[model samples]
Target: MSDSSQLPYRPCAGVMLVNQAGKVFVGQRIDSTLDAWQMPQGGIDDGEDAETAALREIGEETGIDPSLVRIVARARHELFYDLPSDLIGKVWKGRYRGQRQHWFLARFTGTDDDVKIDTDHPEFRAWKWAEPSELPAMIVPFKRKLYEDVIAEFAPWLESIA
Candidate 1:
């Protein structure tokens, strides 16, 4: 087996999309049988800036148009997470150890009707608006700490708009 330590982390962008009521968006992944839920995120394309990648991910994953959301705050630094050992060779074609992500906080300006998860390629089987504090518990275990850190960095903005 290839040593996971020798692998690089994937470059990714993530978004914590909150609604006017302060509830954040979490989606149950279509690919996972587990009850894992996560915010919109995906690998950043080459030459795409993190913010642009973040907006694209939201539209790709949730089918929510960029015009329906407003970017609020960005995490001060990238957050890193390692995939579980068992998954290291199975995911991302075994090219990545995990992910190093740039995360953004966006506010959903449109009503609930605007969210349509059945996009050209849907990532989530189901989606919901969740309380910000519930993020860590909702995510897959490997990404829980990363979610917590995102909430911490965006806490002030989350509160101000609440």
Candidate 2:
């Protein structure tokens, strides 16, 4: 019963980074053994804006220069998903039930060679570009619904419109 979890969902930001080919970036978390992959996401630091958090998380998790991503879309509203009961008290220092995230869709303006996963505080062990349709199935089961919502919300980015 962490004080934070008792409050509500953790404030977070997420990114759907799409390349010119319309493929979204996916990463295999270094901390997971379940083959759970995810888009870049993380807590929105105190006093930081959601968009800023999204960009920072992208750089920290994937080593992509924030300058190389052009904003395409922002989620119309925040989206939430709860961690499984078994995980609620075991993850994030038991400080969050899950995340309530503000998602951003950005176009990767750089080439594939510009992606360097060896970030300062690396969160991913591996990464790749995959069709947006595959996102929901690629993430952890608990977050599938969240991914689906994200994919739907950023359908335009998936079409390479940005």
Candidate 3:
């Protein structure tokens, strides 16, 4: 296998949208059959700031407007994860080997009614609120490490409200 450096990592932003109860939102992807769930995330568009991209991703994936969330915290640095070897050349038009993501923690001020998963370009088919501690097990195996890191980085903020 070629070293990961041979392919660039996708620049992406992830949002950990938490409600008043402090549970994070997770979605079942429309493109996968494994029943894996994930927080809102997407590519960072050219010329867009990470925070703005994160908010945009939330809106695009969850149909929740940016106005509904209150920023809680942001990771001090981007986190990297390599795609599985079989996925290295199949996903993202083979442009990226994996994702290097900047994750944001945001509190959902709006009620559950505000979340509409059926967006114009829906990435998820179903969704729910789950304990942040359950994230690692809920995500796809390939993304577990990234989810674990997300929990670690966002733990204090989650605890503050719990």
* TM per candidate: 0.98, 0.93, 0.96
Q: Return the top candidate by TM-score.
A: 1
Pairs in steric clash, model 2: none
| Candidates 1 and 3 compared by TM-score, better number | 1
- The segments of candidate 2 whose C-alpha lies over 4 angstroms from its true place after superposition are 1-7, 160-162
What ranges in model 1 sit over 4 Å off?
none
Q: What is the C-alpha lDDT profile of model 3 across 1-162, one tens digit per residue? A: 566568889999998989989899999999999979999998999999999999989999998988998888999899988888888778898888899999999989998899999999999999999999999999989999999999999888897753
TM-score of 3: 0.96
Q: Which segments of model 3 are wrong by more than 4 Å?
A: 1-4
Instruction: Report the lDDT of model 1 for residue 142.
Output: 90
lDDT for model 1, on a 0 to 1 scale?
A: 0.93
Q: What is the lDDT of residue 73 in candidate 1?
A: 90
